[model samples]
Target: MSAPKQDAWVGHLGPAGFDLRSDTMTTPTASMLAAIQSCSLLDDVFVEDPTTIELESHVAELAGKEAALLVLSGTMGNQLALRSLLTQPPYSVLCDHRAHIIKYEAGGFVHSFCLS
Candidate 1:
């Protein structure tokens, strides 16, 4: 007779180990906490905080422009960039078919930027 074989059973995830697909997991690293704590509380609209000032300078240097402004996210950044280019509203915003703003942002670009 053949040697005893292992059955086809799970080991860890769920009943075996760690399931990454579950949302009830994860803890932020100490570095992340430190960074969050280090961020100064200031109104970025006026560029008052040193952290915001540094970020703006970094973006401006990278974009090869005289200045840059801090925004909330990539979608907001794209919208702001387009808004700055078009002094008047109703201008066209060309974007890829699969762009995050085009698909995920819930018509914000067209409504806010186009109608503003």
Candidate 2:
């Protein structure tokens, strides 16, 4: 008898078992928790956190840039990029009509940039 095809089986669970609804379903690993506990903690808004600055510096070096900023989410990254590049009011961004940034971001970029 022939062996069962791999595609026929439901593969390994991705983050959240069996539910593929969202990509945010992730659990911290032991190393991540350890780092969180061991790393220097500071209010990033009031002071430059050493770890964050190091990470940003590393990323900047890798990308051949003078600076970098770490954002909390994809939405924040997208918004920051747009805010930096758009420069003026009355601009429009083109994307798929069903894109998450357009449909799911609650018009944040559009409203923030005064885009039409």
TM-score winner: 2
Give the per-residue lDDT digits (tens) of candidate 1, residues 3-114: 4442222223344443333233445457767898988898766757888899889989999999887766677776777677878745777779987777887888777754
Candidates' TM-scores? 0.57, 0.71
Per-residue CA lDDT of model 2 for 42-93, tens digit only, reads: 8778656999888989999999999999888778887898888888656768
| Overall local distance difference test of candidate 1 | 0.69
Q: Give the CA lDDT, 0 to 100, for residue 86 in model 1.
A: 77
Runs of candidate 2 exceeding 4 Å displacement: 1-23
- Stretches of model 1 off by over 4 angstroms after superposition: 1-28, 87-90, 113-116
Candidate 1 residue pairs in backbone clash: 11-16, 12-16, 12-17, 13-17
Q: Model 2, 100: alpha-carbon shift in Å?
A: 2.1
